[model samples]
Target: MSAVTDNLGLFFGGYLRSLSICLWALVGSLVLGVLVAACRVSPVPPLRAFGAFWVTTFRNTPLSVVLFFCAFGLPELGINRSFFFFGVLGLVLYTSAFVCEAVRSGINSVSAGQAEAARSIGLNFSQGLRYVVLPQALRTVVPPLGSVIIAMFKNSAVVGAFGVGGDLWSTGQTLTSARGLETLPVFVGIAFFYLMITLPAGAILQIVERKVAIAR
Candidate 1:
């Protein structure tokens, strides 16, 4: 009991810190994903090429490699890490690549008639997207996007490798090493911590989807 109490602070703090990083990663990825999706859908060939290239590059590369490059490799080029910004940046960019594909598929699921109708109403491309296409497309994509968010949350745990302190996975490693507890228990704790976040978020998304469906 004393052992658990002693480590509770570390466990909770690490979870919170990791959650923070995950939240930033979620927002950053969503933004970048939307931009990439827009580029992929744009009429401009160059924009589509750029988006495709980015998606393929990040998708092919392991995320840990991306983190390593940002955390370790960048300093070689005089880029410095200040408070794990590089780790967050890498996670965001890497996760965004996948999220982009999710969102692009979502946008594609929306009927082309929506765009045409908006254009008939005098909306420009951006305006049509903002008012008509994105809203409907977002509704269609909620379930998949929710999965992406959950996945990103889980993946953010990897930032611990970059020496970013105070993440659940890193804390688990520290506790396991110091306490020499059974590996199973430590991993169980880590898995439970992740489930606590992801399960509820997924449920919420489902609820939203149901509501959207009912409204339609």
Candidate 2:
């Protein structure tokens, strides 16, 4: 208990690192996920096939393997960068697969007539998706997407294990191993910090779900 209290600043720094990783991963995944979703729904056969391949390859691959590849594999190919960069990249790549699927499901839920209506108004495919289909699809998938983001918050812990220093998980390790603090208390503090992020997110998502339901 004293260890946790004395090292509050250390633990807080770690929490902020984890938060940064989550935020960066979330933005990257959402952008890439939307593009991939567009590809999956594209009229172009090659685009659809590419999108399918991406989803299959990443979605089936374990997150740890993906991180391993990014952490150890990329530098061999001359893509050297910080472990933090690689960690975030791996998270983005892995999470984007799930995000793609979620958005694709939402796109499927949208009425086909919506696309036809957009086309009838002289809108191109890109314009139709941007102005019409995606807007509605996004609203429909809000809950699922929220779940994905929440999962991402938990998954960010893995990044610290892969040499991205100064994250909550690694901080716990430092306390337990280096500082010789009691493991249980250190991890209890770590769990508390994670819950701090996820619980409020879940609450906000529920509120958003309610408002969306009312709007519908």
- Clashes (N, CA, C under 3 Å) per candidate: 0, 0
Q: Candidate 1: lDDT of 215? A: 74
How many angstroms is residue 8 displaced in model 1 relative to the true structure, after the best TM-score fit?
1.4
State the lDDT of candidate 2 residue by residue for 1-216, as single tens digits: 787899999999998999899889989999999999999999999999999999999999999999999999999999999999999999999999899999999999999999999999999999999999998898899899999999988999998899999999999989999978999889989999999888988998899989888887
User: Which residue window of length 10 is worst by lDDT in model 2?
Assistant: 207-216
TM-score per model over all chains? 0.91, 0.98
Give the per-residue lDDT of model 1 (tens digit) for 45-155. Answer: 999999999999999999999998888888899988654798899999899988899888878989899999999999988788788988888877877888888888888
**Model 2: residues with Cα > 4 Å off, grouped in runs:** none
How big is the positional error of residue 142 in model 2, measured in Å on the Cα after superposition?
1.0
Per-residue lDDT, model 1, residue 31, is 96
lDDT of each: 0.84, 0.93
**Model 1 TM-score, 2 decimals:** 0.91
Tell me, by TM-score, which candidate is best: 2
Stretches off by above 4 angstroms in model 1 are: 1-5, 179-182
